[model samples]
Structure formats: structure tokens, C-alpha cells
Target: MAGPTPDELRSVVDRFPTPPDAEAFGRADELLDGTYSAIAESWYPELRRLATAYAEGDVLRESVLEHVEAVPSFRISEGATPLTRRREALATAAETLDSVAEVSAWYDDLRTLLADSPDSRSLLERLLHDFGYAAAHVLFLGASSPEQVVRRLRWAYRTVGVRIDSVSSEAGTERTTFTCPYRDVAAGRCGKRWVCHEKLDRVDDGYVTYLRERGIDYQRPRGCAESERCHSSVARDGPSQWWPKTPPSAVEREP
Candidate 1:
């Protein structure tokens, strides 16, 4: 597939709530952009090295790239209520880490299987496990807070098997209907701390008006490039005029 268009990427990102502060968003954007760049730049070389060791050659490299390119974008607006905001942030973080972890696990397995000889299998297996752990750690470190990262990573791994068929399918309903342990309704860490079980509704005129009152800018472009620009702007200067009026907060708080 031709890599995800900017629009597709934005659609993924637009699903999550924005950070409460411009700096948070900026840092998150930087981390995301850097992660994307690192994968784009190093994945091929790393794949090539691993492929050579396993004798799979470029085929493995190509496969990995195809998988990475297939990842859907995810984003959420910060217009949600505080409870919703917390839940969305946790969910978004967990999902993002899960994607990276899954990819890492797959690569590790491939690497182990490709070992040059039977003698290499043990070493390769260890290496692969380390690699997978490292990949997850990289994501965790890039997150806004270490505690949040750890919590979400644990949640993501535990809930890996659950599935949501489609966003459009779930858009009109409340999150309580979902039957996963990770669902925010179970009075667990996520339920008590995040709002994962909140309902989602269409952005009606009233909601839009609310956003306007808050000074959030909502005129998002439907195209890919423009969408990237929109994210870039928010990453740099916070949201435009259509989101809630809460000003961006500082990055470091004792909390």
C-alpha cells in the first residue's frame, strides 16, 4: 500500500484528546514526529542487518516496512470533559504503545527464526526479547509522564486481545457497552482514574458552540497535507480557536 496519506494519519490522531497544555502537545508531537522519523530512517537498515543474519535478505525488511506503514493514525480533541479527557489520553497512550510493542514482538520472532544457524537460535531469541522490551521502553520514555506510561503500557499489554471493529461502529454509543476488562466501567485504575466509559456523540452545533467559547479552532481540513499542517500548528502553538478555552499548562507539575 502507498504509505498512509496525511488525512489517514490525521484521522488516527484526531481520535484522541489533545493534551491540556501547548507544551505537552508540543512535546508529544515532537516525540511522535521523532519516532516516525526514526522508524522511517532506521527501520530499513535495522531490518537489513537482521535479515542478513537470518539469511532472509530484503524480503523481511520489506515486510516490516509494509506493516509499519499500515498502522492507522489516532488523535483526540481536547474538547472532552475532564473525565473523558483523562480516559482518552490513557486509551490513546495505551493503544500507541500496543502498536509499537506488537510490531517489536513480530520483528523479534522473525529475527529468531532467521538465525544463521542452529547455534544462533539461543542468542537470537535473547536478542529478540531484549529488542522487544527496548521498543516498548522507548515508547514509554517518550510519553508525557513515566507513571502514565507505565500504567498505560501495562493496560495495553493486558488488553491486547480485545478489539473494536471500527470507530464508526462505536461512535454513537456509550463506552459502557464494551465488554473488556479494560473498559472504564469496572472501577479499576482506568475507571477510577480515566473516563474510558464515556459516551461519544456527534459534534453537534451546541458542542461546536462550546468549543468556540473555549477558543478552540475546529476548521480542520479534510485533506492529508493540510491535516498535517493543522497538527503541526497545534504542536507548535496549541489549538486554534475551536477547542475549550483552558490555556495550555506547564509540562512539569509535582502532581
Candidate 2:
């Protein structure tokens, strides 16, 4: 008989018992480190799936596996926790969704995972940052009508207990305001209060970039992360037209 081929080897490895015990988790850690054969790359997906099957449920196996695989090798910090790494991976996956249906499906998985893992505040912030950009691109970039856009955005956030207060347009101007779920949802996750504020700021930047790309003017003044209530406004006119309408701030007035 021929020596075990890669597929045969993989089959045998897959058959290895996957129990929810310390030893299995240790095996996962070893597998993640490429401790087995030289064909570690090929085994990664299967290992992730097995790991998920052992930890979470079978339904989440694929989603969790995809989430774990999305993290490029360079992105995983040397000392980061596995949970942190997985969350970042999920952010990359969630942000790359190309359609409304895809985005909705991702949000469903993410919402449930976040609720079950409350200590994942930092991860939640990362997801929201990417999600804001994705949402803006999908809704504001001709994917849906303004009404549908607002409704979809509201629905996504509501799944996580966050409310999108307003999304409206008037005389070629659009403005939106919403409460920051991170404030309540991620209260004890971080060591400092300012860290939470920083997270909000970053997410707002993603939103602002989305509007800026489409020649829309975003009118949120100062840092939004500092405020419990976040808000953003956009004018339909291009950047050139929007720039002249607003009064100059003290920074701009300085000699």
C-alpha cells in the first residue's frame, strides 16, 4: 500500500477525538502553532472547524471557523488572547460583506456571539468600527433607498440592544443620531473610561470616510467619542460646496 497521502493523513487527523476538555483545548493551541506536520496550512481550516465544534455548537462551526481564518498571520499579536484574535478576525469578515443579505447574516451571528460574550467589549468596538463603514457603504452607496437604509441600520443595531434614534434627510441634507451601545454594553471591559471614548472616535471616522467618499459633507463637530450620544450629518453637495457653508472654527482662524 502507498504511504498515507495528504488527504489520508488529514482524514486520520480529523478522526481524532474532539472533546470539550483541557487536553483538547491544548491540542487546539498546538495545532494553531503548526505543531503537527508540514502541511499545517491545509489543516488550519479543519482544525478551526473541529475547535469550534468542540467549544461552541455545530451551527456556529462554519461561521466561527471563517471568523478565525480571516485573521492574517501578521495581524495576530504575539501576546494577544485567542478571544481577541478571533474577534478581530470576525471584524474583518463582517466588514467585507458585499450585499445587504450578507451583512444581515453576519450581524445575526455577531449579535448572538456578543451577547453571549459580554467581556468582549474591545472586540465589539472593533466590529462596530468596521460595521459602521460597511453599513454606510451599503446604505449610502446606492444599495438601498434612504428609508430602507435607515430601517436596515436600525434593525442591525437593535439586535444588540442599541437604538438608532434618527436617520432623516431634509433639503438635501442627511443627519443621523444614535446612542452608543458600547457605553452600557461594554462598561467593565476596559480599564479606563477614555478607552471607550477612543473606540467611539475610531468608529465615527469609518462613518465619516464613507460619506466623504461619495462627495457628501459630514457635519459632526468635535470628537463624537467624547459624547454619550453620537451624531453625524451629511450634505448632498460635494466637498467644495459643503466646505464654504460652515463657519471656520478657532483652529482655522489662527494666524
Candidate 3:
């Protein structure tokens, strides 16, 4: 596949899907931003207490606090752009962190601290929903070419921890099918893998629909959260031939 040109990349980036509650989520983040410092002040000490209890020392505890404290406000940064425009926010947040390991540790401690708070749990769930949208952003977007689009789709799924166990193509057709393991959520080690089947289906629908809308035929025949496993195929002409086999009807044709 060819590398995506700047314009082509922009075209794909333009169509990224926004979470259903994006506006509400953005407002919540904005409100939280105003109180984040106070929240951190109130909570960091408690986190430190937990750290001590868990045998984590001041050095490591302080490191976590510093990282969280320095995080940029999590509001939807691109107000001029559609709410659908979302990848930059996640990518920016990712850049703010030192490493993937740091991200994992930060969340692990936060979850531990908030384990007993129902209100906090609800807020965390919203954050996670948005997180999934960001992780799967590229799957709903366009690409420089059909081949590049497929490449982007595969890469996006992998980023969300969806392993592509196998891939094969049918002869004379640009159709390619990828089989995935049965795990429903692909949140990697981020600890937010509790996403529901509904959300997973939405992601799969968006991916397949985006391909179809852009003239690349495709279908998602199975969803890991709802079926035996996740499976999706793309073709050049259309998805009709890719549908599951069905027995011929007993009734005669109108020939």
C-alpha cells in the first residue's frame, strides 16, 4: 500500500466518528477541567495513602501525581471542527504521558482509588466510552486508496488490541477477510476493556459502512461481543458475494 498523502490523510481524518454522547462528554470534561486541580488536591493525598498501603513509596506516588497533574484539560479541543473530529484529542493526551506503562499505572491507581465511589465509576465509564471511540477512529475514516484504507482499518483494530489472527483474499477479487479472536473488547492492557456489546457492534458497523460508502465493499459477519468471534471482509465490487451461505429455496424460480 502506498503511504497516505497529506490531503488523503486529511480526508480520512475528517470523517472520524464521534461518540454518541460527545457533546455531553465534552461538557463534563470542561466542568471537570475547572475542578481538576481541586479534585487532584483532594484525591492525591488519598492516593498517596493507598500507595503507602500498597507498599508503593513516596517517589513513585509523587511521580504518578506529577504526571496526572500535568495532563492538559481533556475537553474536546477542536470546537471549530465537528464533534466527530476526535483523534487529535486522544493523540494529544497520549503524547502528554511519558509512556504506555505510565498510562497503565496511572489508571490502575485511579481505579483502585475510585473503586467504591459510584459517582466516580459513572464518570470513568464515560471517559472509557470516549476512549474507545478515539481508539477506533481510523476505522471509520477514508484513506488515499482502497488498499491504504484496509491497511488503516487493520492498524486501528490492532491499536485497540484486536489481534488479526488470519487474513485471506479470494481469487480475482479485492475481497479480504480477517478473523479475530473471541475477546469482545480490545482495550489492550488499559483496564477499560469492559466495553459493552452494543458499543462493539457500533464500531463494527461504522467500519463496514465507511468502507461501503467509500465504494469499497465490505461486511462484518460476526461480532466478538455477540457471536462466536469477530470477522470482517472487504471486496472491490460489493459485499453480496461475501454473505454467509444459505440453502437454496425449495420453491422454483420464475424462469
Candidate 4:
């Protein structure tokens, strides 16, 4: 087959599919490894330019690290299919790049410290002498903080999967409407939470309707002024009364 055109290569990389099984994960890994390697090799000059910009100071490194840390981790279930594994791997790579940015920052800090303290610890001096050049090379060439670089990294990390979009409101008559996605409620195993940031005309009716429409299962906020008027408990109400009480069903009528 003829080699893929630049646009074709981008299309393939930009729309990475989420794998569905272990076999798929392996396939995706191979594909990504080959594709990224090729791109990096072909675009060595551009990559070098970015690296030079990043090595100039800490701003780029900090920005790149911040972006990396912001990338979310995929949830994998028991007996996760190849697709899940692939998605997890991509996410992990993105995370690792973020970690690399952090390490780069540490390296920069160490250099600054060494510049100020030439007589620093022997161990520290030895370590810097060992890895300083390598660290500089990575900072300048591997991860740049420009928008284009960051965007490309993000694209490389996305799983080839469906994207979900949701919209919700905060008013209506329903009581409870929010639901928690965390595995352990007591220990707060998950960092997710349903927050009602909307200001409704009526706290109960509008809020309930909003929650119901959104399929959120939640409870009233403790010490809420409108709790007395709400049918749900004023404090510590159950999920049933929370707005957006459950995940929305497409076939079912909107509450």
C-alpha cells in the first residue's frame, strides 16, 4: 500500500480508537508505537525547535507538567477488554510524560541549586554530573510547552472511543437528583461529586426538576435554607431525594 499522506497520518493519530479487548490493546500499542516513532523521526527539526524553547526556562516545563497532571486516568474494570487496556496505556503514557515534565523541573531546580552552591554534597554533585546532560536533552527535545506540542501529546493519548456530552439544569419540582460515581461512599473512594452550581428561581421545584432531567441521584445540602420547604429531609437526605437522581435513560421520558 502507498504510504499514508501527512493528513492521513494525522487523521489516524488524532482519532485513536479505544480498544475493546486484550488483543486490541496489543494492536493499538504496536500501531501507536510505530506511528509516533515515525512522526517523531520525520519531524525531528520541529521537535528540536520545541525542545530548545522549553530548555530556555521553567515556564514551559511547569506548563507541560500542569497539562500532564490534568490528564485523567481511565477506569478499568475486572476482566477489562483489550480496548480498556489500550485506553489505560495511552492515558498512562500521557501521565508519564507529565511525570517526565516534573522530573525535568526537578532537574532544573537542581541546576539552579548547584549554580548557587558549588560546594554542595558530593552525592548531589555526582548525580547531577551523571544525569544533567541527559536531563537537558529531554527538556529541550522531548517535551515542549507550546500549544501545538501539548495538543499533539493530548491527541496521542486519547483512546479511540466514543465521546459523551451531557447538559443539565438546576430547577424543577423533583427532590433528590444527583448520584455519586465513586466506588466507596464512606471512604470517598472516588473523587467525583455532583455539585449544583445553578441558581434556581425556586430551590425545591426547579432544583428537583433539574436533577430529575439530568438523572442525578443526590440529597439536599445540609443546613440549606430551603430544606424545610423541601419534602426531602432537611439534613442527610437519601439519594432518592437528590436532584439528577439517576443516569438519564434515552428511551424514558425526561423528568
Candidate 5:
């Protein structure tokens, strides 16, 4: 799973704090970890089997999905106590959309399982694109301006331990750190490209996708590797630029 969720992140604020049920939040995380493991255990093998079936001919996407199950799904009731159920429902958002490790594992699984199939690389790319697009939707949408992006991302990134420093009229958002937990995960095994392109770029790209949908231009953010803090801009498109033009201090107003 990913880090603490948007709900869990509701407390990950310094400026305007809305402390979540700290106990419930931790419980939700444990539930998610368990459910994720259950999904992998129950479905990964079956999925590999189905991949063989798909290589044979036309397999309905639904057919593949019918066999996949993760807990706390909409179709089923978790029936956790009222207090816990809300948190558990919130945990659903933590599913494997943005997980680089899970994504790469899927890549490996599909490649290994479907190696003998025709145009497998193209097929893999198509699958990955579909998955990535879906993942981006889970990032955010309907943001009104660059400031909205900053406001939302400011708290959301807190789960990953990032702190927003400022956002310029030009849509450049200064950050206390561009580094994420992913950078440290399996540090020795994964290279710079995997950490940056696969893990980090997805976060930037999700915002880019949403901005582009509104016909707003966006320049993806970049962080300084050498400095303690990385300041980057979100710039794109024509003369009419838009961003949350609030001064940095304004970001910390009382909730």
C-alpha cells in the first residue's frame, strides 16, 4: 500500500490542524497492510494463471477482475464497528494504484507469464498506461487553480513527510524537501532512475494530467539534489498563468 491516506493525512498538517483519531488512523494502516497482503496471496497466483489464459486468446477484462479480490470493497460490507468502519472505508483509497513496487511487480509478472505471447512489450505498455491513468485519477481532480494544487498537495504530501514552503504567482511551489520515503526504500537495490522516474515522477505527472485536463499548462516540478531544500515551479502553457498566489505565511492560517 501507499503511505497514510488523505484521511490519515488530515492530521499531517502544521498550519491548520485537524487531528484524526490517532488510534483509528494507526488501526486503518494495519488493516490496509493486512488486506494488501491478503490480496496478493489470494490473487497473484490466480492472476498468473489467468495471464496464461489471456495469452491463448481474447480474455475479457472483467474475467481477469472477477478473480481479483481485495477486502473492504464496495460490493461487500466490512461490518467493522461504526467507529472503525469509516476509517476502514477511507483505507480503500490506499489500494495499489501508485505503488511503484507493485507496478514493477506487475510488469515482471506479466512479462514472465506472457513472454511467449505476441507483441508482449506493446501489450505491457498498454496495460501499464491504463493502470497509470487510473492511478492519476486517484491523485486529485477539479482543482480550481495552482494554489488549490498547493493547498491540497501540502497536506497530502505530509503522509510522505514533505513540507510545502511557498507557492509563487508563477505556480512554482517551494518545498522543504523533495525527498520521499520511496527514495530510501530498498535504496541499494533501486537506481536513481527507478526512484525518480518510476516512483517520484508519477506524483508530478498526476498533477500535470489534472492541470492539462482543464486546458491549463503545467511545468513539472523539480528538486535540487544537492541542497537541503528544493524549490521548483509548476509552469506551462500561455500568457495567462495561474497559481495559488498566496504568500507562504498565508498557507498556515488557522483552520
Candidate 6:
């Protein structure tokens, strides 16, 4: 059996994250400036909470701080460059893509410490749903057609380095055929034991909340672990329950 060549690997690595279709999905440019940071800012705190719950205020909680601090922070500011121009718009998109990569790597860090914990996947899934939920508010804000929803979702996962191949409708519901987010992470964990099929798209919580806002409910018919390709479908709403729980703001604002 031949392994992937350097060029082959580079091609796959380079392919991620083609920008969302602007006409179908709305305000992707809107995401570059504020939405990416807002999502991470929300995500980081909730992740900390989940970790604390897992650590239960023990020494492991202190290790959580060190582990978190190891991942560099991400923030995108409004530079002198105006997004109206093609180049600047592309730059912003590129930066947003980078931000997604940073978030994914941060989750990858958690896999080591939290993988063995029974409650970890559920906590992580809730946080992922919240990430997609926040993203939908901005990325798909003005777009709601079925095609647009699919495009928005593809873009959402692409930002996190997951490639979705196609979206199809069945029984009045839409399903996406895509690679699992854990495909890359699997080699690091499951060798012959193959404990992942049971895991079934822990990262797809984003898909559920993201698509649900668009008025769709879903079913994932195929969850096979032998191959990286997975047929996935979804489920949910945003955080009135506060989507994985956030701390109250220190200051109240004017209406």
C-alpha cells in the first residue's frame, strides 16, 4: 500500500476552506471582523467551565489553565485595509480561516486530557453547537433558502477544516455527506481498537444547531468508522439556555 505523497498531502491541506458562496450565504465578510472573535471569546469561557467541571476543582483544574494558555489566542482587528476592496476582503477571509484552524487545534489539545472522561464528549458537543449557533447569527444572517443553508453549513465546517462533499434531501430533511472532524485525530488514538464509530461526529453538534435554526431536523443514517467518509444529518436552537452556559456580563447595557 502506498502512503500519500508530500504533494498529495499538500493538496488536501490546501483544499480546505474555500470561502462560502457570497450570493447564497450572506455576510461572510461580516464574519472576518467581529464574528470570529466573538465565537472564540464565547467558546473559550464555556470550554473552561466544562474543564473545571471535569476537574472538579482538583489539581487537574490547574493543568487546564496551563493547557489552555499553551494555545495562542486569536483576534482579528479592523486594520487600515478596507474590506470593500477584493484583496482586503480576501485577506479577511484568510484570517478567519486561520482563526478556525486555531480553534480546531485548541480542541485537539483537549482530546488528550478529556478523551478518557465519560462526560467530555457531551460537554464538547454542546460547546461546538454553540460555536455554530453564534456563527449562524452572523454568517447566515440574511440567507435562509435551503441551498443557502447548505452552503452556510459547508462554509461553517470548512472554517474548522472539515470538507463536506454534498448535501441531499430525503423525507423532507437534508443530509450532508462529509468527512468526520475526527478523521485527522483518529490515527492518534484508535489503532486496532477502533473506538470511534461509537463517537459518531462529536464535532457535528455545530451542524445540528446551525441547520436547525434554518428549520430543518436531521438523521445521520451512516456512522461507519472503517472509512473517513461519513453521511451525517442533524438537529437545535440557539442559547436562550445560553448554549453551553456563559457567565453573566459584568455590566448591564442600555437598550
Candidate 6: regions farther than 4 A off: 1-125, 166-172, 184-186, 190-203, 219-222, 234-255
lDDT per prediction?
A: 0.30, 0.41, 0.38, 0.28, 0.39, 0.42
- Candidate 5 residue-wise lDDT at 82: 29
Query: How should the candidates be ordered by lDDT, best one leading?
Result: 6, 2, 5, 3, 1, 4
Q: List TM-score per model, in order.
A: 0.19, 0.32, 0.31, 0.17, 0.35, 0.34
TM-score of 2: 0.32
Give me candidate 5's TM-score against the actual structure. Answer: 0.35
List where candidate 2 sits over 4 angstroms from the true fold.
Answer: 1-152, 166-169, 184-196, 218-228, 240-255
- Given candidate 1, what's the lDDT at residue 80? 40
Residue-wise C-alpha lDDT for candidate 6, range 1-255, written one tens digit per residue = 111233432333333333344432234335333444444456455444535443342222222323343333222222332223433443444444443343343344443333323244455545555664566577767765555655666676677666787777754345788775554445544432122332333334444455565765433325433345766554322222110011111001111
In model 3, residue pairs whose N, Cα or C atoms come closer than 3 Å (at least 3 residues apart or on different chains), thus clashing, are none
Residue-level lDDT tens digits of model 4 in 34-102: 333332344333333433433442122222222222222222222222344433444444343332223
The TM-score ranking, best first, is: 5, 6, 2, 3, 1, 4
RMSD of each: 23.1, 20.9, 22.4, 25.1, 21.4, 19.0
Best by lDDT: 6
Runs in model 3 with CA error above 4 Å?
A: 1-146, 172-196, 221-229, 239-255
For residues 105-184, could you state the per-residue lDDT of candidate 5 as single tens digits?
34334333322222432444445444544654665465655565555555666766665555456334323235444444
Assess candidate 4 and give its lDDT.
Answer: 0.28
